[model samples]
Target: MLRKALLTGCTGFVGHPLLARLSNCDFSVVACSRVAMPALPASATNVLVSGIDGLTDWQVALAGVEVVIHSAARVHVMNDQSSDPLAEFRKVNVEGTLNLARQAAEAGVRRFIFISSIKVNGEGTPLGSPYRADAQPQPADPYGVSKMEAEQGLRALAAETGMEVVIIRPTLVYGPGVKANFLSMMRWLHKGVPLPFGAIHNQRSLVALDNLVDLIVTCIDHPAAANQTFLVSDGEDLSTTELLRRMATALGKPARLLPVPSWLLEAGASILGKKALSQRLCGSLQVDISKTRELLGWTPPLSVDAALRKTAAHFLEHRTH
Candidate 1:
């Protein structure tokens, strides 16, 4: 019998690819989306939920689900107008996630895979030092704090219910249909817009969407992955300048980078009230995925160059339409 798997946020960036990957696996997918996703594979049973809050009904989706992949959450929003960001984030990320976990456990779900963020480890790491799976969590923002709290709650619940829990903390994930910072960079490179990241020598680790989805599928049935926390990446780190150059090359455009000082960029961002954005563009945030490899005996199948090229090709092909 094919195991039933419940997936949250199947309409989102990561969720979309994950659902596609699961289609080829030995599991039947129950894709839960907040809105209609008509393009999903016919094999997937689409469940449109009203919300992901504590009061949301998930009985229909959780029926006979052997695995639960929780990917939906209150993500970061620029210019957020919430009166209390932390409380608002907690309501969904922490409360809603635990509610789903509890319901899944009651429904006899065998494994619960929680897709978390690298920010749960901390904002950024120091030079030449990468974050480990066992690092003490130091969530800086409200989103990170909520994820940290959710992880703690899930662990406690696992201890009580004996439901296998596997947590994966991934860095910036980029691929086709990727949005936000990665998309913006791709667009800039495609348009030949000059950027000032040539002086940034900080190393940052990133993961491809395909790579992350592969690991999640592994955890779904791997006995060694139970009750484990993993820091996953592409096993390759790159500097900002190198990343942009490669992206531009993939787009068949010249990398227009100005060799401006990182300090100057920080000062300008401070004046513009974008200190955090500047830090992200210029800071190091590498993760050590040795534990994930050692435990799961898995490696990322896609190389960084291959992922970037794929992303660039997709962007170029779609932009002309």
Candidate 2:
């Protein structure tokens, strides 16, 4: 059967890689965007339709859209201030999401796939525990709070309209074209600089770009994905120190991590007004994706090491190019 898909955030990190994978699917895609796209595949009967817009303007394209992939969100960054952070995040992530959900439902779209973050579980990992899909969400930042709210809102809309809602919570995604923290870490490793991350011994789960994209496709095909929130990662957990070491190896750089005492690191963080940063760097953040694996019968295609290598190679190539 020929399925028509409506995709939001078509210009995002996840979307870029996903486009490549979707080229082979039984999908006729129509992309909606708020910002201008750099370029796109020529809209053919195969691609069917593609357009750019704010949520209010989605009706025309949403008319025959069979599925909607909502990946747009205002991500987290330090010291970020918008007049109303929650409102700002909600404007796009929540309200915009709801708008599309309603339209898709009205258009008889079969599924509404929401790309949520693991932050919906919590802000940071506790010393010993990993975040599970079943855990009650205790979001910290405005961004996390908004995503959780959207999850609730989407779920409500789905229930009201009888549209299948598939939620995917991906953790610390890393890959080429990666930005934010992952990019910062790559730059730090490339510098051959020593880091205090050696004192941390907490495992955090992360999903590679390819692995995450793969799971999205899986969810599209898996009946179990309907009306479910699936936690996904590489299924490999690493402490901050271990992560730095592995990233360094990927870049062929020395893992020059200093073994500072945890308490001392905390004290230094306090002095630097970076207690949050200290906690994040030294804390154990992990995600249990067994629900995704067992239910969907899927596994990550690339190991974390391979994913890191590919990301590093992109950075290297970027510099050379």
lDDT of 1 by residue, 66-98 (tens): 899999999998889989999999989999999
Q: Which lDDT values do the candidates have, in the order given?
A: 0.91, 0.81
Pull out the clashing pairs in model 2: none
TM-score of each: 0.98, 0.92
Question: On residues 1-321, what C-alpha lDDT tens digit does candidate 2 reach at each position?
Answer: 657777767778998677656656867667656655656654412232233223466667776777788886777756766677787777777887787788788888898899999888986777567888989999888888888988998899888999999999998889998887778888888887787778777778889999999999888868888999999999999888889999999999998899987788889999999988777777767888888889999999999999999999999889632
lDDT for 95 (candidate 1) = 92
